[model samples]
Target: MRLSSKHVLVLSIASMAGHGAMAGQAESKGFIEDSHLDFMTRNLYWNHDYHSGHNNAQRTADRDRREWGQTFRLDFSSGFTQGLVGFGVDLSGYTVIKLDGGAGHSGQAGVLVPEGNSTAHEASSAGANLKVRVSETELKYGNNLRPYNPVFAPADARLTPATATGFWVVSNELKGLVAEAAHLTAAKDFNSTNLSDDFFAAYAGVASDTVDFLGASYSVTDQLSVSLYGAEYKDIWRQYYGNANYTYPLSDNQSLNFDANLYRTVDEGSSRAGDIDTTAYSLAAAYTWGAHTFKLTYQKIHGDQPFDYLGMGPGTFHDSIYLANSSQLVDFNGPNEKSWGAFYNLDMAAYGVPGLSFGARYIVGRDVDGSRMDADSPYNFYGSERSEDHWERDLEVKYVVQEGSAKGLSVRVRQATHRIGNGASDASADQVRLIVEYPWSIF
Candidate 1:
C-alpha cells in the first residue's frame, strides 16, 4: 500500500493523540554536572580490486585502490540547565591522517579524499550545535547533526562519519513513541574536511537546495513496532517510507523475527531527476538459537529508473537507503530489479570465547531493465541496459577487549566480492577492510 505525505502526517498525529499519557521529564541537572567528554581513535586499512577482463572496456584506468588512514575523534555534550526550558550544547571534532596511499592507489575509494592525483596527507573538521528542551521534546540547530531515520541517514562506513547542517526536532512525549522532523541544508562528506557540501541525488547527481522530512515510530507491544516517514528533496521528488518489525520468542535462547520495509517515490516540483515514479520494498525473516542466527531477505524495485537516494559528492553514497538488500559493496537497487539474500551470524560467547563474532551474507539480483526510461531523463544513461544480473558475497569477523585497560577496544575485518553480468552497470570487484578502534571517556 502507498501513502501520501499528508496521509503520513495525519497518521502520525493520530497515533500521537491515541497515546494519551505523557512521559514526565526528569529534573534537569546543572550544566557541567552531567556533561560528558569522549575521545576515540580508529585505524583503517581498505583495499578494493576491480577484476579485469569484463566485456566493458571503459573500466581500465585505475582497477585497484588501496588506502590506510587513522582517525581521532572528540565529542562533548553539556548538561541542560535547571529550568522549565533547558538549554545545552554539543561539540565534535575529527581528524584523519593518511597512513598509506601512494600516487597509483589513492582516489575514487571512500577511504580518503584525493588531492590532485594523490591522497591528502591529513584533514580535520569541527562543528557545534545548540539545543533546547521542554518536557519530553528537544530541538537542535547545528552543523554537527547526525540524523538516522528511514528518510535520511549519514554514512559512516569509512574513516570518518558524515555530518549535516540542519535543524532537527525530536519528541518522545508519549511512552514507546518517537517523533522527528528535520530540515537539512548541507552535509560534510565522509572523506572530506569541507563543512558544507551540496546535497545531490545518489544516482542522477541532480542537486537540491534542501531536504525536509518528518517521521514517527511507535511500539504497539513489547515485540512489535511500526514506523512511517515522508520526505521532500526540494524540487526533485517526494518519498514516503513505512516499516514494521516483530519478534516472537520460542524459548530462553530461541527467537524469530520478521521485518518489512516499503518506499514510494514520485516526481515533484521541477522533477530534476525526471519523471521518477517508483515503489521499492523488502521483507526479511530471521531465526536465532543460542549462538547462531540465520536470515533470509527478498527485495524488489518497480520503476524504470534505478532506486536511488541522497549523496554528498561524487561516489559518496550515503546510508540513507534502509533496504534489506543493500550490502557492503552494492545496494542491488537496479531498475526493475528483484533480489534475494541469505545471511548467517555466530557469536563465540556461547563457546566460551567472549567478545568474538563472525558473520556472512550473500545476495543476488536479476531482471534489471532500464530500457523504459524517458529519452531525456537523467537516468536514460541506463536505458541501454536490459536483463542484467549481479551478485555479492561478504564475510566478517570481529573481536573486542572485554576487560582491563584495553576494554572498549575492538578490531574487525571484512571481505566482499561482487560480480556483474554483461549488461550491468556495475563492475566486478573484491574488497577488504581492516579496522581497529579504541575509545576513552573523561569527566
Candidate 2:
C-alpha cells in the first residue's frame, strides 16, 4: 500500500518526538496567549523594453512589458501548547489584483502576474502548516515552505509567493551548529492553482516523485562559518553543496569579508537528465568602511549543460549566493559561462539621512559554450553553442519612513539595462521596477 503524504508526516513526526531536545524554553504566556497575526501589503510596477528586434524569435512574438499589481499577504501563528510535546499551527494566504495588465500588451516573464488570458485578472491561495516543538527542535508539514538549501527555495518576486508540500525538521540541539532534513513531494508555482512534480523534474523530461535532503551549518567562531548540504531527486539527479564565509576586522570601522560557494551534481537512478556531471562554484570579496562598501565577485560553470536550478516558473528569481549578478533579469548561468562583477553601495545615514540608501553594480559574462544541447528537449532550453558575451548594469535606491504613522512604510526603485555583446537574443532588454511594502501587526 502506498502511504499518503499526510500519513508519512504523522509517522515521521511521532518517530522523531523521542529524540526531541527538552531544553526548550517554556511559553509562560500559554498557547492562545502568544498567538500572533500580521499583514504585509505590496504594490508593484514593472516595465521592460525588448531590444532584440526581429533577430530573436521571442522578441518578435511578444511586445514590451508594462504592468502593475497590488498584493496582500496575511500570516497567523499560534504559540505551542504548554507541554512536553507542544503543538502549534501556522497559516498564510495572499490575494492579488491586477491593476493594469493585458495580453499582447505586455510580457510577464513570471515577475508580475502570470500571462493567462490577461494574467488571470487576479489570483489567490491559502496554505497551512502543522508544527510540533521540543527543546530547540521543530517538525513541520505544510504547503507554505521556504527551504534555504542550495537545491531549492520559494519564489517571492511575484504578486503571490510560491509554495511546496513537504515534511521537514530543524534542530539546534548542539551549540553553534544547526541540522535540518526534509522530504518534499510537490510544489506550486507563484501563479498556479495546483501542486505537482514540476519545477526541477520538468527540465529533465521526467517527473520527480520526491526530493529528499540533509544539511548542516556550523559557526566555527565569531568571524568564520561553514555549511554542507546534500539532496537527491528520485529518478533525476543527486546534488551536493558546500559554502564558507569569513570576516576580518581592520581598524575600528573597517572590515573585509570573503565568501565562497560550491556545488557538485551527478545524474542518478534513471538518469532522466542525461548523464549530468557538473561542478559549479563562485567567490566574492567585499570591503566595508563606515557608510561606504565595495565588492567583487567571480563565478564559473563547468559542464556541457547550463547550471540549472528550480524556480516558481520560468526562473523569476533565486536566493542563491553563488549566481547573484545584480538582478539584471538574467542569472548568467549559461553553460560554461564565466562572469565577473563589481558593486558599490552608499549608506545615507552617515550624511544625516538615516532611512535612505543607494547602490550600483555591473556584471560581465563571457566564455559561454552551449554546444552540446539536445535539440529535442521539451523545455525551452536556450543552450547555445556559439561563443558570445553579455553585460548588465543595475542601479537601486531605497528609503523607509523613520517615525510617525508611516514609520514602517518602505519604498524601493530598481533599474537595469542588459545587452548582448554580439547576438540577437530576446534576453537583451531594459527594465525598471518600483515596489512599495507596508507591514502591520494585529494581536
Off-target runs (Cα >4 Å) in candidate 2 are 1-21, 25-28, 53-60, 102-104, 107-109, 112-115, 201-209, 314-317, 324-326, 373-384, 423-426
Candidate 1 error regions (>4 Å) = 1-25, 52-60, 114-119
Q: Give the TM-score comparing model 2 with the true structure, all chains together.
A: 0.89
lDDT of 1 by residue, 1-443 (tens): 88654455455444543443323234667678879999999999988888843433434655787888899999999988777667899999888888877457635566775322353688788999998877777778999998888878888878788888988878787788899877788888887777778777888878886888898899999999999998988788888999999999999999999999999999888999999999999999999999999999999999998888988775568887989999988888888999999999999999999999999999999998988888898776565778888899999999999999999999999999999865647779999999999999977
Q: What is the C-alpha lDDT of each candidate?
A: 0.83, 0.73
- Estimate the TM-score of every prediction: 0.92, 0.89
Candidate number achieving the greatest lDDT relative to the actual structure = 1
Whole-model lDDT, model 2 = 0.73
Point to the candidate with the largest TM-score.
1
